[model samples]
Target: MTLTLHLDAAGWREHLQSVRNDVPGLVPVAKGNGYGFGLARLAAETSALGVDTLAVGTSLEVDQVRAGGWDGDIVVLTPWSRHDPVATALLGDPQVITTVSRVDDLTTILELNPQARLLAELLTSMKRHGLGRADLPALRSLAPVARFEGWTIHLPMRSPDPLAEARELATAAQAAVEAPVWLSHLPLDDYATLRSELNVEARLRMGTALWLGAPKTRRTTARVLDLHPVRRGERVGYWQRRASRDGWVVVVSGGTANGVALSAPTSAASLKQRAVALATGALDASGHALSPYTIAGRKRSFVEPPHMQSSLVFLPGAAGVAIGDEVPVELRLTTATVDQVVDE
Candidate 1:
């Protein structure tokens, strides 16, 4: 059976409004598993925002968005030199703005299809694709051959400072090209300030903040796969950490496949907070109580590490709980893989 994921349509709409209010001209990011809402739904939702452009991850995803009848400028974030079929996506002029990172790719795009829109990518995080600012002059010099739309920078998710980086990018972009500048994958809070600081016409390709900005708008949950009673002296599981007291051992139908570890930490912490994860991992090593269970709609501590396609959890005396019950799970939609959406 497929795992069930619930989404708050109203909640998502509310979050969308909040983002738009904060950043007047917001470009919502909708790519990859639709951030758990699926592409069709996000395309439909974002189309309602009246935006001229929406960012897709790649060419394959272009069809996913196009199939839904989203008639807008599609900016594919990945570089155009992404293999054959992908590279060919850059050859078409059907409203796709392909990224050109290298000086060679610039000539390749124009030679293949001079009609296509080419937005030069400056080197940023992920270290893949894009020309360096120092090398930007060569590409800018080729603007006459290609239909240069603007400049773009892919900032780091783990960087300590993004605005400063944005400023540097703007300065470098000023030297390279005069077209509108764009950015990909930056924090939502940083956008308005950065856009203000730059004080020019700029665009940001947003994914999480636009789709998963408000936590209450989306949530994920899985079915209780199995349950068993445990005794105080009962020896159980891989690590054998023995039960401190009698309780119920439970299991849920969710693991890595469902984007379990796709997390976005609070604030701008580059690294994840290890306090809870380490404690949970330690419990799994101890091999005593299970970890993935819920009572009265609350997550339970795990007894052991999450196994393939499932996780074990321990429930310590919650009222009227049982097997096969759909427990409430607190998943960060901005960070979790969404399996399904329940329109509300």
Candidate 2:
């Protein structure tokens, strides 16, 4: 048995249809481990959704999407440069669209392939990528030679009011290129308002909200492979850390290799959330930590850091679990990869 992801097909289908209906021109984003469903799997789902376009993060992922028999148009979100030969080659594909954040990249793309289809990305408050408002004139100059698909606004995860921000950026994007605007992380309720206020054709590029918007539709679990009775103060795991109490040491499938026991900086907004993050950071400073594995309806502490392919979980002596029993696990989908994904 291995770490597995289970999908409630009927519920998932209902949610998918609901989103598809809500967002008339929804672009399903299938990148970054395909939100832990794999790239090819999401591509097939995108096709089933009957959308004409799909967005990916990198050029290498374009091939994987195509391999999934997705013949629809593909737009790579990451800006491309001469430094990326693979991405350039991928741009030669008729169906592949590129996003140009810098003026020079646009020049390079046009010089190499004047027929290239492109999107001019306007720098949002995110500041991660895209051309600034000042770069709009230069983008307009290069607009003639390049086949301009639209403009894009990559919004931040938590914006005070994304609709207001999008409304503000709409003017800059429209001035730069007289074309439609594509955005990410925009809420469904504000779609109509964004279009009416901005007076532009806005397309929503979604990944997490599309795949994981409804948490009740999916479940992830790891199987118990072995169990060992441990005594208090007995050293365990690779670090040889002593157990605080007598408990059953449980080995469960899923570890660092599968993106278990891995973490990212917290995006907490509230003061209480920040305090919890600080506490979590303090615990991480020490060798002791908690694992994602849930045993007996409670998350168990790790004996040590996870191994490459499995983790050691500590369950109290009174707790009971047989080998091969599947336990629930909460994982970050973007960072996670599983051996199997079962549609139940």
Model 2: lDDT of residue 88 = 90
Q: Against the correct fold, how does model 1 do in TM-score?
A: 0.83
Best-matching candidate per TM-score? 2
lDDT of 2 by residue, 128-209 (tens): 8988878888877888777989898889989899988888888877876778889888787876778766665778998999
Whole-model lDDT, model 2:
0.87
Give one digit per residue, the lDDT tens place, for model 1 in 161-270.
Answer: 87778777778787666767787666666767777766468887778767766776555567877778887767666667576678877767776666553344334332
Off by over 4 Å in 1: 1-3, 125-128, 185-200, 232-245, 261-281, 288-293, 296-298, 307-309, 317-320, 332-335
Instruction: Estimate the TM-score for candidate 2.
Output: 0.96
